[model samples]
Target: MTTARPAPPRPTTAALKVPYRRPALLERIGEHPAGIVAACWVLLLAILCLLAPVIAPYGYNDQDLGNVLAGPSAAHWLGTDPLGRDILSRLLYGGTDAFVGIVQVTLVAVLVGLPTGIAAGYLKGAFDAVSSRLADIILALPSLIILLLLFAIDPSARTAAMITLGLLFSPSLFRIARAMSLQASQELYVRFAEVSRVRKGLIMLRHILPTALPPVVVNLSLMAAFALIIQSGLAFLNFGVLPPQASWGGMLQDAQMVISEAAWMMVPPAVAIGSLVVCFITIGDAARDIVAAATTPRRRSRRGESLEVSVGSVDAEESIVVAPSPTALLRVRGLGLSRAASGTEPAAPLVTDLGFELQPGESIGIVGESGCGKSVTTLALLGLLPANITVDRGEVVFDGEDLTTASKSRMQQLRGRRIGYVSQDPMVGLDPCYRVSNQMIETIRRHSDLSKSAASERAIELLRSVQLHEPERVMSRYPHELSGGMAQRVCIALALAGDPDVLIADEPTTSLDVTVQHGILQLLEQIKRDKGLSLILITHDLNIVPALCDKLLVLYAGDVVEHGPTLDVVTRPRHPYTRRLLDCGLHGVERGEPFPLIEGTVPHPGTWPDGCRFRARCGLATAACAEPGARAVRRDGAVIARCITVREGASEAAALVGAVRTIARPVSVIGDDPNAEEADRG
Candidate 1:
C-alpha cells in the first residue's frame, strides 16, 4: 500500500523498466575468466600438496647424490637441491606446510581483528576508546623485531612464529574493519534495527559484518600472500620448519645457495610462491567485482499502471462526484484521478468521482476489494500520488482549507503535524536511517516546542500508549529487530509523534495475523476513545467497520457505491457489491460449510460495463443496469447507492439487498465449475 493505487482516468505510471537479480556464488565466480583460471590453479596446487606423501615420486628427504644438479630426467624430474633431495618432491611436500600456515595465519587475523574492529566502531564509548588505543599500540610495535626475538629464543618455533606473524597482521585488519563498521553503523537500516530493539550481535552479523566482508575478504587474501612471503623469508633465514619438515622458504634457501652452480634450481620454488600469491590477489579482485555487479540495479514500477480487463462495453463506469458537508473536519468532494497519456498508452480514467466527509472524533472506513481505489484515495488526500496520475477534479477541504490546491509548504504543515499517517508496512514507514531515539524525538520536536529531552520522553510515552512493551528498549533497535506486531506498534507510535488530530491509516493490518490484527484494531479504538482523534481508515476488511468506523464508504471500480452510517450500511448494505463484500467476510460456519465468495476480480480501469460498475460481477444484474448513466442516486441524507433499482422511487425501508442466495451463487466465469468450491472445502 506504500504505492498509491490507480483510481480511474489518466493516472501516472513509470516510463522506464528494468529487471533485478542477484547472481549465485559459482556463477559470480565463473563470470571472471582470469579469476576462474586462477581459482582452478590454486585448487590444483592445494590438492597436489595435500597428497604429497601418497603421490610424490620420491620422499622429500630421499637424496639422489648421482643426480645432483641434473636437469629433468628419470631419476629426478626437477633435478636435485644442494642437499641432493628431489626438487619436485620437496616442492610438493613444502606446499602442504605453506597451505596450512597461510590458512592458519589468515583465520587468526580475521577472527581477532574483524570482531574487535566491529565492537570498537559500533559499541564506542569506553570500549571504543580502549580498543582503538590498543590497536594503535599493536600497530606501533616492530613486527619483524618481535619475531626475531621469538626465533632467537627457539629456532624450531615455526608454529609460534606464524601465530605471532598473524597477530602482527591483525592491527591492519582491525583498522579496516573499524572504519567500515563506523560507516555501516551510520546507515539507516542499521539504526532502525538496533534503535528499534534488535540484538547488538545480530546487528554486527546481519548488517555491519556483511557491509565490511567484501573489503575484508580482499585484505585477507593479501594477508595470505604476506604470510607465504614471511614464511619463506623466515625459513630462508633458517628460523622456519626444522630439517625433518619440508618448508618452501627453506627450499628457496637451498636453491639460492646453488643458484650460480645450477640457476635452474631457483625456478621451482620461485614460481610456486609467486604464482600462488598472484592467484590470491586475482580472486580478491573477482570477489569485489562480483559483489558490485550483483547489487547495482534497482526496480521501481509505476503503481498507476493497473491490470486491464479484456472484455468491456463501449463505455466505462459513469463519472459521479457527490457533494460534501461544509462544516465537517474534512470533506472530500469529487476526488477523481485520470492517468496521463504516455508513449502509446492513451489517457484513461481509473478512479473518478469519490466524495466523503469526516466529522471530528469520527472513524470512517473506506471499504473495498483490491484495486478498488482504497489506497490511492488515501494517497490523493496527502497529495502523494505518482507523477503520472493527476487529480482531474476534487477538493480535499480540511478545516476550511482546500488541501488539493494547498501549496507544498502549507501541505507539509498539515501532513505530519495536523494529520498523521500510519502506512501499511510499519518497517518501511519508519525512517530508520537515523537512530530510533533521534528520529522519534526529532519528529516530535518538529511540530512542537518540546526540548530534546522532553521529546525523547514523549517518544517513549507514545510507544507505551500503543501497548508496546519496553518502549525504552525499542528506541535503540532497528527495523528487522522488531516483530511484525511490534513493527506495527512502532509505526503507530511514530505517527502519534506529532499528536495530530487526524490519523490516516492505509491498510495498516493487511499483513498481520488474526490475533495481531485484533490487537491493532483494539489499540486504534482505544486511541480514538482517549484522544478523540478522527480516523480515516482505508481497508478491504468490512469486519473492522462497526468496531471502529462511525461511518462507512463502500467503493468499487473507483466509485463510491454506498456511503452511510456504519451500523446502517454493514447491517443492511444497499449496493449489491457491498452486500457481497459482507457475505464473503468471515462467518461462524462449521467445518465443511463453504465460505461465500465473489466470482470474478474487479474490472480493470476504463473497462467497466456501460451501466453499473458492479453489474459485471453482481449476481442480480438486470438488463436495466446496462444503461450508461446508471450512477448512484441519493437514498438518505448522505447515503447513496449506485444501483439504478434503488433510485428515487424506492421506499426508505425497502430492503436494498438482493436475496442472500444471489450472493452465494457459483462462479460465473465461462469455464469455472460451480461445485469446485464446495468440493474443496468439504
Candidate 2:
C-alpha cells in the first residue's frame, strides 16, 4: 500500500512572508528639519575648511604694509591690522589655527581620558579611588596661574597655552566619562556580555564606547570652543603668539591701544571670535538637545486618528511563504549564568540550569519577578551581558553555528541581520535627532547591500507593514514628533527591516498606554502569524502568556519553578510557587477585592535557601524540606514539582488548606474570638 508521506507537514500560517527591504539615508534625514539644518551647517563648515586656500585672496599670515589700519574697502576688506596685515587674511588663518587646536585637544582628551575614566569607573575600588583623587587634585590647582607660570618659564607662549588648556580640560573629561561608564557598566546588556564570554576590549569599544561617545562628542565641542577662547585670551594678554604673528586675541589687544584711531580693528577681530564661539555653542547645544530628545519618553500624538488596518491585505497569498522546520532552527541547552564574586565559598548561580528550544515559527514567553534573571537570560542569548557575570555552561546552536563559541565578528553579523532585538525602552533604543525613517534606514544599511533608493522604498514598505499611518509623513518626521506608540511601531519596523529569524522582545509594551499596549500586542501577534518568526518574549505580565506564547518558563528568584505548555501552566500549576503566583494575580482574586500579594521578597542570590530555593516562603515546607538540597519530583507527563513531599498527600493537602485559611482570615480578628468579645460586653 502506497501511503502519502504525511502531507509534507503543512507550512505554518503564522510566519511572515514578505520580501526583505531597507530605507535610504536621505529619505530619513528629510523627515527632520532640525537635523537637516544641523547637517547643512556642518557641511558648510567642512567645505569652508577644505577649500580655505582657494577661497582666501591672500595668505593667512601675509601682511600688506600699504594698507595698515585701513577700514572696509575693495582692496583691504574688513581693514588691515597694525602690522598692515589683511584683517580678513588673519581671520582665515586664525580660524585654521583655532580649528587645529579644537581638533587636537578634543582628540587628545577622548583618546587619553575616555578609556582611563571608563576603566576607573567600571572597575572601581583601587582604580576608581586613585582616579577620583587625582581628578580632585587637578581641579584644586589654579589653571590660569599655572598657565601664566608656564608661559613665564617657557619661551614659546603658544606651547604653554595649549599644554595648559589640555591639562585644565582633562579633569572634566574624566568626570563625564566616569559617570557615563558607571551607568552603562550596570546595565543588563553589559551583564549579558560578561556572561557570553565577550572580550573586555570588545565590550569597552563596541558596547560601552558607542553609548559613551555621543555625550563625549558634545562635551568635546564645548571644550574646543573654550580652548579657542583661552588661547585668544592669552594672546590678548601678550603672553601668546608673540611678535609679528597675529591672532584674533592679539589683534584685539593692539586695537585697544589704538581704539580711538582704529576702532575697526577691535570690532572685526572681536566679531570673528564671537561668531566662531557662537557657532560651536550652537552646534553643541543642538547635539545635546538631540541626544536628550532621543532619550526622552515620547508623548502620544493627539492629532492623529487611530488607524487599524487588517494584516492580510498588504501581501498577496502567492507572495506569503512558509517558515522552515522547527528542529532545523535554533536550540539552546543547559544554558546557565550568574553574577557573584568568586571566592573560597562556591558562588550561587543567578540563572541555574535554564534550557529551552525555539521552533522556526514558535513564540515562547519567559515570565518572572524582577531580578529573576529573565532579562539576563535573553542578554546571554544575544551575547550582551554585563562584566561582573559569568556564564558557567551553555550551548546555543543556531543554523548549524554554535553561537556560544562564535567569534565577535560572527556574532555582530548575526545580531542585526540574522537576529533582531526590540529593546524594552524604545526611548533609549532610538537616536532622537534622527527622523524615524532615518533610523530605520540606518539599520537596513548596516545589514543589507541594497542601494539608497531600494532601501528607502523598503523602509517605507516596512513602515506600512507595521501598520504605521501616513508612512511617508512619519518617515520624514523626527523621533520627537512621534508619540510613544508611534515610536514603538517604528522600532518594530526597524526590527523587521533585516527580516530576522529570531526576535527577542524585552518588555516591549511596558512604557505604552493600555490602548497602545493592546495595539502593539495585536500587531506583534499579527506579525508572528504572518512571518512564522521565532520569538523569546521577556515579560512580567502573566496575562500576556496565554494569548501570545505557546510554552512558558516561570522564573522566581533566578530559578525556574515551573515549565510546560502555556495553557497547562496557567490552568494547573504543579509547583507551589507557580500556584501562589497565579492565586495572587488579578484574575484569581474576587472582583473589587484587593488582589492577593506574594508574602516575602525574593531572596538575593547569595542568601538563597540551602534546601529548596522557595522553601522559606513555601506553605508546604516541612522538616524534610528544611533538609539540604531539594530534588525535582515528576508528576503527570512533563510537569516537575520541586517539593519533597508530593507523596505525603494528606499532610501536604492539610498544609495547603491551612495556608489558604491563614490568607483568607482577616488580621483584625486573628487569635480573637467574636464570642469572647460579646461575653466581655455582657
- Residues 309-373 of candidate 1: C-alpha lDDT, one tens digit per residue: 32221223333444556558988877777777542233567676787788899989999999899
Cα error of candidate 2 at position 482, Å: 2.3
Give each model a TM-score.
Answer: 0.51, 0.51
Candidate 1, residue 89: Cα displacement in angstroms equals 64
- For 271-302, candidate 2 gives per-residue lDDT tens digits of 76776666676666555545444443332323
lDDT of each: 0.77, 0.69
Note the clash tally of each candidate.
33, 22
Which runs of model 1 end up more than 4 angstroms from their true locations?
1-326, 343-345, 432-434, 636-638, 647-682
Q: After superposition, how far is residue 348 of candidate 2 from its true place, in Å?
A: 4.7
